[model samples]
Target chain A: MSEPIAGAPNGEPLSSDRPPAPSPEEAIRPDGRWLAQVEAASGVKAGACYGCKKCSNGCPLSFAMDLHPYQVVRYLQLGQMDKLEGSSTVWICASCQTCLTRCPNQVDLPRLMDWLKEELVRRGQAAPEEKVRLFHQLFLKGVAKRGRVFEGELMAGYMLKTGGAFGPEAIKNARLGLTMLKKGRMKLLPERNKDRRWLKALFREPKGGSHA
Target chain B: MPEVSYYPGCSLEATAKDYAESVEGVCEALDIELRELPDWNCCGASAAHSLDHRAALNLGARNLALAAQGPSPLVVPCALCYNRLASARHELLEGDDLVIDEIKALGGGYAGVEVVELNDYLSSPEVTALAKQRATDLDLSGLKAVCYYGCQGQRPPAVTGKADYENPQGLDRLLGALGVTVMDWPFKTDCCGASHSVPRPDLVFTLVAKLYKRALDQGANCIVTGCQMCQANLDMYQEEIAKQMGKQVYLPVLYFTEVMGLALGIDETPKWLKRHLVSPKGLLEKAQLPRQTWERL
Candidate 1:
């Protein structure tokens, strides 16, 4: 069985040779003001964006958004968190980090974009969109139940939650769904074991729930 | 023997059980002790970054912490999971102002836990020496394979470090060790539309078609991958693509471990290879290993 998972800080175990990180209270806004009081702890840099627009280039859903990838970082730099989160720009990033790899400065625009999305979700102030919330819920649901995403089951569950599970559309997609089921692609009962209970305990027992 | 914390991710447990089995079998062969981490979470794999960023890091971090409970580095089998976890590790250690306090927020965080890819582990001289020693009468001379690294496996080479992000030829070397002829293919690390199949099947058909066209044109009998998502995308979505294209494209997808098993003759069986959406039974027949379909893995 897999072990009780830790947070992001636990993933990279740098040796003593690595340098220590900056404090959240030390971070400055793009306006050069001390704005670390309410800042969520993260390693995303507000600068280093070269304005190459590579992230938008690879984003599959970029056309559906109001702002582009580099633009999202620009807004964050200008201390415009409201616009960053209000628009669908951050939600559609795909978090593929394409721009991060291509950036001359190695700017992690996707990471910053993701941080903005989490803040919006935590504040319950996200734009009126079900896809973003549904995406987050599907991920957490998979983690809560079995600690991994069962794609076939997760999709149907997401459809059910988004209220796309019935009527003509459902009937139409039902054939595709049946094909999936017949292929042994879909599981009727999510394989739940005793370890799932231990996972829950580990998650809930973490200090402060580990979220900003 | 060094014991490393292993993350099976989601697919390996059930959907891709053979992968876990083969990995364990290989680990035993190499005397590599793999302690499956307890209370592990998903690596935030494909969807977490799109849904929420911190949650994705948080998700990756959680898994790292489970591995951090000991001195052993993380060994992830699924390339996608390794990429996500490794990316998360890179972010956490970048030492930006935010990571410092995020540590404080989550009390007593993992101070040191380096994430290692399974390919890095498998490609080690130690494991290779063991594989050579454990060699049986496995003749994989006839199998033609295209080593498909997929996007997450090879690219972002800075994060994965398993192979070159730009032009990875490591899998070819691994295949060479197994004595299988690998095709020179251009779309090795190309995108398969990834989890995009869930929301948009149209794009998946296009992506899979491109892959099939390139691999088939390059003379590959099957597509072998380190990612379960990629295997599923190529294997599962091809039928949908054929229906759309109004023709048949029968290029089966096989796991890299299965290919290694074929070469090493370690519990190689038709039933194990059959779970692939495309039955490699005929392909296995082409190789003609010693064990019948049922007597081995």
Candidate 2:
């Protein structure tokens, strides 16, 4: 019917940055505006969150998370970046969107959380373990190389990174590893490639690359 | 004159041969050429990567390289295969230079020919126009389906493009045209645990609960998916979930392609459909195909 309102609740993808690390006076609903931008971009949320916890009920990882989906939306809506900034909520999200889909207010919790996490990482407020960050880095890095992810090389690099980064934890999952290999699940190494230059050329903007 | 490089992945070759057969028929109807990549191996699917990432990526890379030998873009009907190939392509292109160099030492230059998920490949406006032109008069207006994208189709939206990586209903749109009703279910992209079901039935039960309950809650008679792993996991694990949860929730799962094939009126009940632990025969009823004559086909 009527153009489902062209942009997100607030508008289109925000071309602007975060609200200057939340000044106290401006902090009342600081994270709110930028998150609204992200919510708009995702085209899922039509407006800002009103602190509803319906998302928490279906969340698989709620107990393990430091910031609940509702809490993440609230912090952003309230301009509380300090709480949203160093939050473990982003990584804890399976990016499942269960909460967002179930939210009555149409608040896109994942997009809001991811937007905050990116801001936190970029600004050095959130110190994600270099090892854990490897997963995120590898995904983007794969895209920059092939205009898509190179699973072969990525898996190899990921394993090496995982083993190097989390020692025993990586090894502790060996039973899973054994199961994978038995079922022909494990690959010994990655295949080589010849199109990095073309892939980089195809990217609109290298997301994980250096500062803009 | 159109050609598609086909990567049957592991399932179509081993457990789902009928999918390959039905796909071959559908490809013919669509006038899309299906070429099997030479010497393609396992995609390292969920199994390879869970055990070892490099090996899985490399395994997927091997398939991409083989597809590269052909002129057509690779079309993988299975979601897991597509994600694996796409992920492999991403890694080979963006992975660490030193490690990539090491892989180069073995699998040869990956050639970097593009590999496309079957849905992504078929999703071009051109293909949609073609399907509209070729579909038989099945008039499937009543089939309510939960389009299960599984974990791969959407996610890291940065890679899969604008298709709402989560609740992608593009296929549903196509189905709607053929007269099917799509159910809005939240389990569209939840984990079916893939091949892990064999070794970890416990984990699968939880994931399966999420899948069936959502679809059941949505009043769907069947779940449509593009990934073989999704079908196998849901179809095979539903009973397991039933036994564990002590509740009977049976939702037939079918490859979205199979539904398309049936709706298009080529319903011989491709043998692979029978391979599924969950019965998807209700699709024929959904497709409204004349039961007696075609059942013999």
Candidate 3:
């Protein structure tokens, strides 16, 4: 269930059916109310963070992200949804868990990042990074349909959807495609698992339809 | 001789078919029967989780439920799949009410099945001992390999249960048992930018370039890895990476299974080796191990 109200950067409605955000005064109350919600969702102790930046220091993609691992958590603690949701950090996380595994506080940055991405996708907001988002959409669409990914169909769909179907981009990929074909890596057929309908119903329609 | 329920994941059926074939070949040689998980679906990998957390958990939960029918370790060959499956089990066990509710609703319950990655499953003492015995007549002493653990195998020790995530010893031990030299390199546990290869090949080129350079700097003949994402990215992007650097960077990235299969003296080794982007024929030849048709063709 989703509401038609718009607050996301792309003016898309927030995807979840959760209640409206509390007033600024209620949110910043010193009782740590906002922190509790984050801690509950992420299964991490938000206040336990000493701002040591250990997670940031150890994250492999920190250089590429807008906000480092610790900063995302810090923003979450402060109830800064604007910074948390708008930053490219969430999409760039890669879910590698380097920060989670190496964090002194054992904060689950990867899972938290997943929650953020889920929210972004639900709200139909275009991710700051385009291709990664499109790839995820196409991949899940393939899985939702066939229970598993068909590399040939998936790549072709991706190239077509991205408008690179028959141009320099396709030419560049053709070399790799030929190599894969020769090596038998790219199968021409899609294999359907026995219970395809079950997974198809699960992911539902791809919302935002490849970037609205 | 224990049999395990195997979930080959999507890559193994497609891009990483050699990995699946070699894994089965090696397992057969080790006398470990891999019964395919009946009608298994994709493990949701990074996409499902990114799109919706509950859906991702449910996807993995369904696979675990199928594997639960039999009392065997669930062996997943793809690192991404293994991570997703293991993470789902961990969350279910940790009492994620939503995940547990979804599992129950789907007629799937966690049966305490052990989800193991290929590296962990093959590197167990018994399996390694069996491998050593099987390969007693074969020697790979000349093959200097730097084992790449990549991101999935070592992260969030909670899910991976890897005590030393940074410098995992499983791959090295398995390779060493085959008489191959495991080079000590610094980038063993680094991320190959994971799925970024599909979206941002430019970033992947830089990340892989660093990895290849490290292996090459150590005078390694090739880079061996257990994770599908790591192998695919490094192998698939070698030519592009080499051209970007304007040099002849011909490092053959081999799945550890191929190496193990070779040590076990499997004849299908050449067929598997030929599947690689940057050919490992030269290295296999230089190692003085018995050459397969890969060297000739």
DockQ of each: 0.15, 0.04, 0.45
Candidate 2 segments exceeding 4 Å error: A1-212, B95-112, B270-272, B282-288, B293-297
The per-residue C-alpha lDDT of model 2 at residue A26 equals 51
Could you arrange the candidates by TM-score from highest to lowest?
3, 1, 2
Query: What fraction of correct interface contacts does each candidate retain?
Result: 0.24, 0.00, 0.74
The stretch of ten residues in a row with the least summed lDDT in candidate 2 chain A is A195-204
User: Scored by CA lDDT, what does every candidate get?
Assistant: 0.66, 0.60, 0.81
Candidate 2 residues A126-184, lDDT tens each? Answer: 44434334555565555444433344355457767556326674553454455434433
lDDT tens readout by residue for model 3, B120-160: 98998888888888884777888889999888877788787
- lDDT of candidate 2 over B1-297, digit per residue (tens): 787788876456444545566677767778888888775665654433432344456566656666766866788887767767776776677653423333354454454666677766665677767777777776565567888877766654544444576667677776666567888876677766554343334556677787777788888878887776776677755665777777777687877667667666665545445555565556555556566423532
DockQ of 3: 0.45
Better of 2 and 3 by DockQ: 3
Which candidate number maximizes DockQ? 3
**How many Å off is the CA of B40 in candidate 2?**
1.4
Chain A TM-score, each candidate: 0.70, 0.63, 0.77
User: Which pairs of residues collide in candidate 3?
Assistant: none
- CAPRI docking class of candidate 3: acceptable
TM-score of chain B of 2: 0.86
Which sections of candidate 3 miss by over 4 Å? A1-34, A205-212, B96-107
Q: Model 2 captures what fraction of native contacts? A: 0.00
